[model samples]
Target: METSVLLIEPDPTAAQEITEILQEGGFLPVTRQSFEAVHDSVTDEMPPKAILIGTDNVKESVLSFISELKADPSTQWIPLFILSRTNEDSFRIDCFNAGADEFFLKPIHPKELLARLRGWVNRIGNFEESAFRDPLTKAYNRRYFDLHILLELQKAQKNDYPISVAFIDADKFKSINDNYGHHVGDLVLQGLSKILREKTRTSDLVARYGGEEFVILFPKASGDQAANRIQTILEYVRENPVAEYEGQLRHITFSCGVAEWKPGLSVTEWVKLADDGVYEAKGQGRNRVILSNLQTSEHDHLEEKKKVLIVAGKGMSKSIVCEIDSLAYEIQEWQQGIEEVPPEICIYVIPPTKGFDAGEYEQFRMKHLPKECKTLLLTENHKALDSFQIMATGIDGYLRGPYLPGDIELGLRRLTNLN
Candidate 1:
């Protein structure tokens, strides 16, 4: 069980030497040619546990890249190490500020480097151990799931994708332990784990949250998509008995509550939303898949055509305008001099434009936008909105520019609660 580490180094000689050192340390080192290539590994079945940036060209752009990674929830937790040729105190401080967990000067001591990495990785969790899994079910443990959902949420936010959670609780699970004995209960849990692993996509995560409780993570999936998959699993569980208790076949059924990640929801809030659905499912008579009720109350406007007011200035891309127009929404455009907002407008698409300022935008929002209307801002990545800006301007969320139609769709979904 070797720990996998990523080395992003453009210099072949440096990369090979580092690779040798990593191999000697009993770790697996994967070398990529560029920073962009590192992101390609994010989709890998097993992403590297840590990342090492070894390069001579540690410029401002590199610092910015480090900041981006640290800003991202998913990649931020990975132990990031920067190997630099210069040992200037100011530059070293800059590296640390940009989110490098450890900074080392080049012409490195191999043993020292390996020791530091090992110590850091061990503190995070030795992937070699069963710390990440449940002993009984062999599914990921609650601790692992808790850490994983945060990363998935961050990844989903950065990539403009949806992530969903399903809280599955075994129905009448106490009865199994009470009547059939705990061994049969453990067998039933194992059977459920097997079915979950077999039924889900390899990318999806299945974890035993606790006794008779499990949670599944579905990245790039909407609530409905998660519900459909859970429904299939529910059907399978109902039709096939999990274990035999004495002479009787012990059938099992589970109720699942599914919730999709929303723009501003916290990890606890999101999980609670899904758990609420599970409660609702049990209330409605167990063994069913239920989507969270939060959407039902928040998205009441869905009963009518979603109304959108497009404020695409001259700088706004024509493609973006077309994309918004293509959505199944009642579309209205803001007239150049018009200050009055139309009634029942659910959202406002405000793209970047020259001569526009945040102060003016705030004033416009106050004067024209309805209190319930959610706003999505479009801007370049370099000028991406910060928390202060988002709060000051009263914007719900933003989409980085040079975005595709799919990106627009996802951004809209985030702001408008669209499926």
Candidate 2:
């Protein structure tokens, strides 16, 4: 592989000469005319193996760049050099103190430059990769993620490939630490790391952003794709508990939010969007993936009300959206399955006229009723013989056929104690 170098030199004449020399020495040089463009160019797929700066004077911008570069643990070890016209004693000392690996007074000398560059490149290549990883979880640390995500966003825009970031926050993590000592919490985190690694693609990145908060970078994936992937992880964790101790099974669940990349958004804004998703998921409940784009439009729904999700057949789930009083609850309709992401009350509409058999409606309700969510049954025909059975199926309330909007609110009030 050709080692890449970030060459920063505003002078085109000097930049071209250095670029050609570096190229001849088997190095791939990515030249940026300004410090601002440097970040736009670097990414996980194209990190510079070394940084080369050419300057006639030590300006504030140059000093700031070097200081910031050294401060970031990700870029700190990559070799840096200052190529200048003056070899003044004070200037040389300042450059060395500012973290430049070497200071050179250059007219031009390709042979000697190549020798030094080669040694720095080799030294960087041999640096322990473990320094970029979180020791306990064995996942890439936040520093690795912070830099790679910025690059991935730039790559996505340039290559016209979709990229997504998912924020995963372990639900009730503090409770786990409190109930089961820190040792078991550590065990659970380790187990979660194993699952995340196993679930993501080899090309994707899995990083422990911080304690109980993880982030995943999905290259060439949309927000929907990221949400689906996280949903799979949610289901797997649900089925398999992370730890078993003292005759009790301990499990950890996470809320995930996925944000797709859009051009012109900064890295901080991109992460904020994904973090908003995680916040929404956790707010709804826990153990679910919520895509920012999937939210109901403000023009169509009300805000700051209890959320009601209706999961039923095609036409059956229709009226609930229109009939729901926005003052009582905010409504979202799902055609196939119940939303595990919190629902204050679920209304399962069963139309007997649609040819669902006598007992089939009860079975359907039993299957789709979310574990913790209160459920209300609105059926057009089950009022006949299934009335007694309906009450016993764990449904909170049942509305007979042809119910009015007033009746809907009444049932909701009864179940949720709004009255």
Candidate 3:
């Protein structure tokens, strides 16, 4: 693919010169007249890899535009460069302060400019790739999947496109690890990652979510389509050996669940739906693929399950219940102030709200919760900086809001080891 560079040059002659220079240097230059036109021209589907602003002087307007570009999440990742006639220290400082990744003085040699541009672009690309990839398997890490899924969800919602998620787990992986050793376990993971990368389309993203578990993001694919593809991979895995154990070729199998995006599903909920399919596949005997059968509005609703006590403001409690309902976990809301709840409670969800007191909640948890039970606090997003104070209260985990029920589900699942 040709690398794209967005060039914002007001002077027509300078713009033409820069365009030619970028093209000759092996970049596809996207020229625009003003900063205001950037938003209209650039899109999420095809954002510029880098940006270059060529100007006569570093004006306050340019600084503001730079700040805006850096603030917007979509464009913030692109490397931004400022080219000016003045090499004044103050102008250079101002550009850096406004989030310019690089500053170049005019009359710069074309080779030098291209070198700097290419170097910065490659540096950013390598840094981002390293941050998003799992070191062991070379697959996308959980953090990448978390951010990417949200973006895909937003795009699917806006463009009325289909997006699907496949939650994959190595069938009986624990036995493999116990019997073979961590070395063979690592080999199996690497082999699975290789197979997924080769079998899936370029548009698909393969991510190692956690211990023996992986997820694939299928953009523009429906649940059925994603499942069929996973089925093919499953058959391939069953037929091929992934690793050698004691001079014996050992094969692996995957249990997969596929869930397509719907009109109103949060990131967690969408992933949870796919996860439920994995659970179903495991239940029906592993080494198969299952598509989520539940609707966006319906949760598994298994009332015979253990209980989760939700203690928050009335509105927040109701919202939590609505989100948790899909996971089929029994919910008991105690918005009137968590004075008391049933003895069968396995999880406690308390959000800091109007009547919330961290100290009080801590005391309640200490007095009531068994070793097998865990407490998760819900704090506002801004309160993340004050996490030390929140954690000092001795909660098992804390979730930052604005969050969906699926977020709660994911958190609780992580803490499920407490039992």
> Local error of candidate 1 at 218, Å?
0.8
TM-score of each: 0.56, 0.45, 0.67
Those runs of model 2 whose alpha carbons end farther than 4 Å from true positions after fitting are: 1-131, 244-249, 294-419
Q: Which parts of model 1 are misplaced by more than 4 Å?
A: 1-3, 16-45, 59-73, 81-132, 239-241, 244-249, 262-273, 292-297, 300-419
lDDT of 1 by residue, 307-356 (tens): 67766543243334444442445666677686544634433434333433
* Angstrom error at residue 205, model 3: 1.9
Instruction: Give the Cα error of residue 27 in candidate 1, in Å.
Output: 6.1
**Predicted structure 1: clash tally:** 0
Per-residue lDDT of candidate 2, residues 186-205 (tens digit)? 88898898899999998789
Model 2 misses residue 193 by how many Å?
Answer: 1.5
Please count the clashing residue pairs in each candidate, in the order shown: 0, 0, 1
Candidate maximizing TM-score? 3
In model 2, how large is the Cα lDDT of residue 187?
85
* Candidate 3 off by > 4 Å: 10-12, 40-46, 56-61, 86-92, 243-248, 296-419
lDDT of 1: 0.75
Which of the predicted structures, 2 or 3, would earn the higher lDDT when compared with the native?
3
